[model samples]
Target chain A: MNVAVIGLGLIGGSLLQALEAAGHAVTGYDADPATRELAEKDGRNVAGSVAEAAAGAEIVALAVPLPVLPGVIAELAGYDGLITDVTSVKGPVRALGIRRFVGGHPMAGKETSGYAAADPALFDGCAWVLCLEPGETDLDDWLTAAALFTALGARVVPATAAEHDRAVAEISHVPHLLAAALARRLVGNPLAAALGAGSFRDGTRVAGTRAELIAAMCGGNATATREVLTAVIDDLRQRLDELSAADPVEALIPALREAGDARRAWPPKPGAAAEEPAGAEELLALGRAGGWVTAVSESRVTVRTMRPESDRITP
Target chain B: MNVAVIGLGLIGGSLLQALEAAGHAVTGYDADPATRELAEKDGRNVAGSVAEAAAGAEIVALAVPLPVLPGVIAELAGYDGLITDVTSVKGPVRALGIRRFVGGHPMAGKETSGYAAADPALFDGCAWVLCLEPGETDLDDWLTAAALFTALGARVVPATAAEHDRAVAEISHVPHLLAAALARRLVGNPLAAALGAGSFRDGTRVAGTRAELIAAMCGGNATATREVLTAVIDDLRQRLDELSAADPVEALIPALREAGDARRAWPPKPGAAAEEPAGAEELLALGRAGGWVTAVSESRVTVRTMRPESDRITP
Candidate 1:
């Protein structure tokens, strides 16, 4: 298979490497001649121009930024074979007038940006969003595009453009915004540098992402991302109100326990809470009560609060 | 040095293993004898009761939950050389009132909970917040306690209890709440379930944390957590209103761009604005010039609109 990858930076360049390792002929393109020259030196066929890259290629993989997508599509509209894009969001990308443009979002990235940070295993086992709309033309072409990325170890799942956007709105876009917002609050705060520990680093590690690219993503998906941000913020506000009126150490155990329980039951199970971590709650309640009724859930009353201040408190 | 770890859970168990691996004589206590028995069977530590574990030990580390902390401290208040506790938050644990107690908040943990998931490299290079107040206590004693954990490959940064909590409020607790709220939205949404690709999984990944624990953390750091959450909710609400009313493709880009720029500049160098992205205003100007900017930042702009949007409109 001949694969033509546009935007030979990180994602596109990595695809070129992976395709070559698989013994397929891989050609790449970029607007920057320097990037093209470097990629050529890296042993991939770096096209002199976008059109040259598309010449005689069986699969044209558009790995350009989301904002530049529509234009990239126009350039590829004349291509005769399968066409796909590795844009993080699919809705806007699919809106472009092009057939066989299978929308793809590879759900993996790293703190390290640029072609230098490209890795062959970047998309391994990662779910790749593949969208084909109802009015789309050439289904066989779409399948051919999907097959190429699938062979590269992506779990290619089919969806509509709307589904793809909304999914990312909830997960990718919203989370990225929150990470940015949270990171923004800390960047200049005196405690930021010293206090920015692992959890902070991991939570906003993606902050190292190309600022321009991410900014456009949030804006591009703003319509879909609006509700996600609102819902999250509302929940956060309510929780903040509930928690802040109290002290962290005095009130934290139960919250942490709840978070721990929720985390334990996630992804691995996909459904169902892991046996309600009854022990931690019980120990917490008992510890809170000092051998009496400490707290009660909606369904059950538990005793063990020893402090008079905590006496008669609902569990 | 002989070390006594008072709880045989994830953090404690791993510490016991690490201490022994480093050739330190380690004694362990888990009020639950079963845990102690397992520690023995696994050759992780010498099996002993709480009192037995502390006997003849130069260091006694309390790895128990905070609610039960006071009792544990009271149980071994007099026996100690540089006592420390591995609680996530420092305020309440410091109130445990041990004479030589030094506070530790290890900035590392797994999505998985408990000893079974404990990793030897858990604390490697991670920032371990050491909260020591002007308690009229000896600094060397607390520093001695810090040295033990530091030996295991942690960067120990000294902080007051209040500083530690505030820092965590911005980075740790707030992020956890955001993850939780995002995950909660998925509770009944079947669309989210089906559309949950890698981005969703990554966004809500930590949302799977234990619920009660998170609840407790919120409760514990209630005030600071509330402050951060309020700011987050307010900012998000404004963003929501803007995007809800405009084309996500247009209206949302500027806000996200600015935010994404600020987020990316974390742990900034002096005059970081030289690295600053194009602000929204600049991007707006650029967009007005037919560039069709998707995101605008302080010094950067992501031109999402294709060049032909002009041709399409004019023709």
Candidate 2:
């Protein structure tokens, strides 16, 4: 397979190296001249521009940052080949309605940025989400993307753009805000800051991320992020009210126990493996059931589901 | 100095070992026979009861769980020697009005709790808070406790019980609740659970803590926790509303930047060292200013303050 990755940043550079190592002819490009020079110096197949990169490629991966995505998307107008992106947010990109486009976001990253920090094994054992919108996304292209990621040692998760956005808002975007909030509380109270230990450090770890990147990710998916943030706030506010009650320990024990049980049972254990020739809806169903695609063929998809006991949410 | 450490769980056992390593005559006791036998087998001076351990000791340290603390406090009804506690909450213990008592809480712990997991170096480089209520606490006892913890390689942070409770709520207790709330969000969403990565893992790290311990710690400091939690919720709510605006990225950039700045500046760098013969009021002021006691003598206390530029909160 011939692959073109635009924007030689951390994710893009990593994908290029990983795909090349997996026997794909990968052409890489970056708007920054120094980055392209670095990649060229490093002996990667560096393309001068997006057109030159995508000219002979079967799959074109847009690995640019969110702010740069629109211009890149516009530049690729009328190519008619399979396209995918590695942007964190999915809804806005999916709404672009590009022909044969499959939205992708690999759930992996590092504190460092740029092509200099790229590693071929960054995606190994990571969950790579591939958006499969009903009646919109091309199945063959989606399968090719899944196969490409699977060969690089990533488990492919199938979902619609809406599901991807909401899931990430719950797991990623909102968490960044929560971390920032926790970090902000330490500001005027130096005594509290001095007392911060493992819990405080871990809770606010992501708060160290660049502010602009967090704002763009959370703001790009504002509606979903807001909804999830509201739900979390509601849960916390209820706990606050309970703490204010006459018997806080007794009032909050049941809820805290439920949370603890759910947390302890998390990243649920994989159970039975089932495979069948599946369409878009079927693949989405498997994903919603806490399952991931172990392998994908032209006619069939194999998924492993979680154990029954661990699958259910604690009531 | 002679010291008695009661309750041989993780913190108690670790404190006992650390104190003994510092060359104190340390006698330990636990209500559980198995724990006492384990300590005795380990060549520790294990006593059958709290009374036996406290007998003829210059200082009695209660390292019991919060629930067990009241019982131990009751048992020490007539103890006239210097006393201190390692309970996370300090207000209730300070309110107990025990003579010659200094309330203490070490900002250090491990996930595993038992005598077997004890380490002599557990408190090294950790902040051990000692409560010094203005008129209620004895200055000599407070200084003695500070000297003892400082000798054990722990920084002594002098604060009033109210101040200590409020600070912990902001830094520790509330962060635990936030981690629990974040963990609870993944309860029913398998897709979200699969998407969990560094941010989710770090943000929810403390959710793995025992539910009962969390409930007691957060509940015991209910008033302070509630106040700090409400402030955090308010901050998050403002961000949610900002995300709903016409230009969310623009609306949220300023607040996010401030938070990022605070986080990055965190741990304000240590500046000049100051020494003075301080009383309870002066020591409390130094703690409030984020200065920690390095050494304590009968006449003077040596304290280090943070760099001026990093000490101010981002406006």
Candidate 3:
């Protein structure tokens, strides 16, 4: 496979290294001459410009910042090869309406950025989202792009561009915004800042990410991000209001329980297969919805159960 | 020192073990007979009643639920000993006005609770807030309480009851609500639940904490908690509104930078001395103010400066 990754930043550089390690013939280019020089000095195949990088490649991946991607895509529109991007948001990329272009976003990153932070193992076991619109890329090109990412040790997930945007808004973009906003609350209080512990650190860990990158992501996916944020604000406002109710503690139980259930339902290890509960068969025989018995206290027995097929499927 | 720990729950049980480990004559009691029996079976001094536990003790620590602390304190008020608590909020505890009572809160816990989850190392490297009113505990008692917590491997921080409540509202209580509310947003989204990764998992980790415990904290400190939540909502709304601006990416930079600064300023390893920065002196000399330099990018250097002395000293 002949591959070219343009814009040699963290994602681009790491993708180049991973592709080359997987035995693909790879060329890389960056608009920044310093980045290109660094990659060239590291014995990587460095191209002088976008045209030179895409010249002989069967696939071209634009790994530039989110806001700069559309312009880069436009520059390489003449190329007949399969094109994809490593941007966090997919709606704008899909809206570009470029032929042979399939939007992609690998769910992997660190707090640091740039060419210096790139590593061949960055995409290992990461989820690489592919916006597989039938009209955009032919079946062969789609399969080729998916196969390339899989070979790079990513779990390739296929979804529509809209679905990708919505899911990312809920799980990634909104969480990042929430983290940043929560961290900002501590800015005025030095004592609170000094006394922060595990919860404070873990909750705001993503806020320490490179500012421009996060800013671009939030800006690019503004509508979806804002929609989630609006809903979140309403939910939080209701929670705060409930704190003043006659039975504040009782009123909070349902919301807290739902949050706990949703959190526990999330897979601990990403990309791992959902495991079958131990003793699931016996529990199913005794109850309508059942799985394994997780714990037992003096007053109650706690069992974790999966919903029945009837209950799981909505009307 | 003779110590009595009322309420053999997670915090109480852990305090009992830590005090006993520190060579104090410790006695434990719980309203639940089963908990007392379990502790006694484990070779602990499990007293049958509050009277038995408080008898001949120099320090009596109340580790019960927030609402129950006042009642327990009232019950043992006749005892001529220093009374303290491990509640999350301090204002209400201070208002109890029991003789020799100084509000105390251990800034440590886990999702799991009760004696079964107790460990002597629970207090290690955690911050213990002590509320010292000039008229309450004498100098000797204050020193004694501080020394006991320090010996249990905690960093004893002294603050007024009001300061303690406000700071905890900004740091712990409000963050817990933010986490639970964020997690609650994903309750109905199956894709978001499945796709939740490090950010979602870590950001919402505290939502899995016991509902009753968090409810108690929020309900008990309704004023401070609500104030922080209101301010947080305003900040978040401003951030969300910024995402829709003409230069959304640029607009998000300050918020992201502030978030990063606050997160970085949090003491990395808790209970350790603040380490001097490598180039802080140079930066301080160059600038009008000095603080922790949070992030450095290609174009910007972000620093978090303390408020001016006049501003910090509120009238």
Which sequence of candidate numbers ranks them by TM-score, best first? 2, 3, 1
Q: Each prediction's Cα RMSD?
A: 18.5, 3.5, 11.4
DockQ for model 3 equals 0.33
TM-score of chain A of each: 0.70, 0.92, 0.79
TM-score of chain B of 2: 0.92
Candidate 3, A49-108: lDDT as tens digits: 898899999999999876687677777866898888988888887787877887888889
Candidate 2 residues lying further than 4 Å off, grouped into runs, are A39-49, A298-315, B26-28, B33-55, B300-315
DockQ for all models, in order?
A: 0.18, 0.71, 0.33
Cα lDDT of model 1 by residue, A157-178, tens digit: 5556776677677756777776
What is candidate 2's TM-score against the reference? 0.90
Docking level for model 1: incorrect
lDDT (10s digit) by residue, model 3, range B194-253: 456888888899888877777877777888888988988998898887987898889988
- Per-model TM-score on C-alpha atoms: 0.58, 0.90, 0.79
Q: Per-residue alpha-carbon lDDT of model 2 for B76-142, expressed as tens digits?
A: 7666799999999888787777778899998888868899999999999788899988888888888
- What is the per-residue lDDT of model 1 for residues B1-315, given as tens digits with 9 covering 90 to 100? 899998878888888887877778998888887777777778766645677788888888888887888888777855756688888778766665667777888777766766666676787766666665664445555546555766787655556677678778887777777766666655534334434544445545555655666666666766667777777777677667766664544555565656556556554332211111233343223222222212122222322222112223332
Sort every candidate by DockQ, greatest first.
2, 3, 1
Q: Predictions ranked by lDDT, top down?
A: 2, 3, 1
